[model samples]
Target: MALLHRAELRPTKLELLAAWLPGRAWFGGEAGADLERVAAYRFDDPAGEVGIETLLVRAGAGPIHQVPLTYRGAPLDGAEPWLVGTCEHSVLGRRWVYDACGDPVYAAALASAILADTGQAEEYFEVDGRREGRAPSMAITVEGAHRADVPQIRSIDRVEDGDPVRIVTESVELAVVRRVGAHTDLPGSRLAGTWANQPTPLPLAYASLR
Candidate 1:
């Protein structure tokens, strides 16, 4: 259970993302594009085996996007069904699975970090991906521990101009500002699988839940 610190890790999350973003349908590719990591922060897990990172990537010619990703020490067996895909780590000599939205441990930690306001020693908001004139004027705070039940956690908070939105994750609860105006809910069957196997839905579908 060796946990790799961000400082000690190479090919930083943005580097991995530069190579990985083009592969996703959500990315709007620009010719001869480059990706710069505008901001990044880590989420701590009690176990510390899995690495959780929240990153804001600025594409050379496209809008900045927040990409949350998880890195595991080893392949998660029986998780092939939930994985977005596997990429060969040139340095680690192992294939790392990319499934930021599905991993349970990562989800739980994200939810907890977003909700806790007792002044943690670690900084989770260091990664600022906001563009000029588009930055959120105010901070978004996680309301409270609504529920950590499986498949959904009902949490709400105000963002920007006091707009409230609920963040529901499998096995853990999180509350955040709904900047995208919508969120997609994963199917029930997909929600039942382990974090590594959970299915991801479009962000728009999440707004429908409200």
Candidate 2:
């Protein structure tokens, strides 16, 4: 299993966003804004070092937006072409870029994690979100590669508040939820409320990951 120290992971997260976010369609900025560390958490990865981080940032007069990101640092030399973007870290003084899900090892590890948590197979999972629209969102391709084994549903849940579901697979755990104001039905509606790990009486559903 590969895990990253919290210290090692945080700076890398900022470096990646600084490099990648400015180019994204959803990013509204002339240049990357200053990113502040709000809250962050970690996940396990059987294949490589995986870090899940959520950042709050103020960009060009827009309200604070939550930028969820994942990081892997296990020498993906040939995989550079698959990265979303790359930048030189002022601290690390090295270049870091976005993850590549097209790689089989990365994809398989992600699929295995989703299946272990949801009891669904790979072929049934579908990556659907407003951010994804017709094209699969970058996060989906990165975090959802292993979802091929899970059921195809609008979303998955482990809490009643409907915020988002966090699941652990192999060694990696991911916070799964729909983009705000994206889908109006099914799993999306289930996320309308805040998410809590404790128990609740909310009605939940399970669909194929097709």
Candidate 3:
């Protein structure tokens, strides 16, 4: 389960994305277009140190976009290039945000989801020491079977951020689709999801063992 705080964020998630998205090569919307949050889903980090969330957003009259992000208390070493920017959390103070494609924890989680069928995490609102169940804004399905062992991804071998953000490791290769609704028939296990305004499940990411 993932615990969520009701604290405020300085430069809300959309604000940060607005300033960063245009710079990405795969971003197809206007540079100054307003982005709307369609929906989101989270993946639990087994260690419980990092927060992994994927946001589905869209600009005016543009295609929905998929952006996977990771939140950390401190800067990720050697990840300066992938840094989206920093935001201050009311409850957690300073947060180091990065593109999930650069986070090993995200890579491991994605691989596990594809190869081991571990779906999205269950979320709860922590209020006054009590946990309240919170329904996920988005739902996902994994096209794979349950597995006992998944390769441990401690570091990333390469990251190629394009239309499909490619994360490569010694044991696996993952392609994170940047634009929603643009599904392709790719080999290997895949992860698909659906949200508001989108009823059909669309490919979000694909992974293959190396």
Error of 3 at 31 (Å): 4.7
Clashing residue pairs for model 1 = 104-195, 182-204, 183-203, 183-204, 183-205, 183-206, 183-207, 184-205, 184-206
User: What are the lDDT figures for the candidates, one per model?
Assistant: 0.42, 0.35, 0.90
Q: Better model by lDDT, 2 or 3?
A: 3
Model 1: ten consecutive residues of lowest lDDT: 188-197
The TM-score measured for candidate 1 stands at 0.52
Candidate 3, 1-210: lDDT as tens digits? 899998999899999999999888788875567999999999999999999999999888788899999999999999999899999999999999999999999999999988898889999997778889899888899876556788889999999879788899999999999997675777678899977767888999998889
lDDT of 2 by residue, 131-208 (tens): 211211112112122233342222222222222333323333333332232223442112111122313222121122
Clashes of each: 9, 22, 0
Query: TM-scores of the models, in the given order?
Result: 0.52, 0.41, 0.96
Instruction: Name the lDDT of candidate 1.
Output: 0.42
Predicted candidate 1 versus true structure: per-residue lDDT over 1-69, tens digit per residue: 122322433455456667766765556546467776554445665675666655555677665455656
List all candidate RMSDs to the true structure.
12.1, 13.8, 1.1
Whichever of 1 and 3 has more TM-score, that candidate is 3
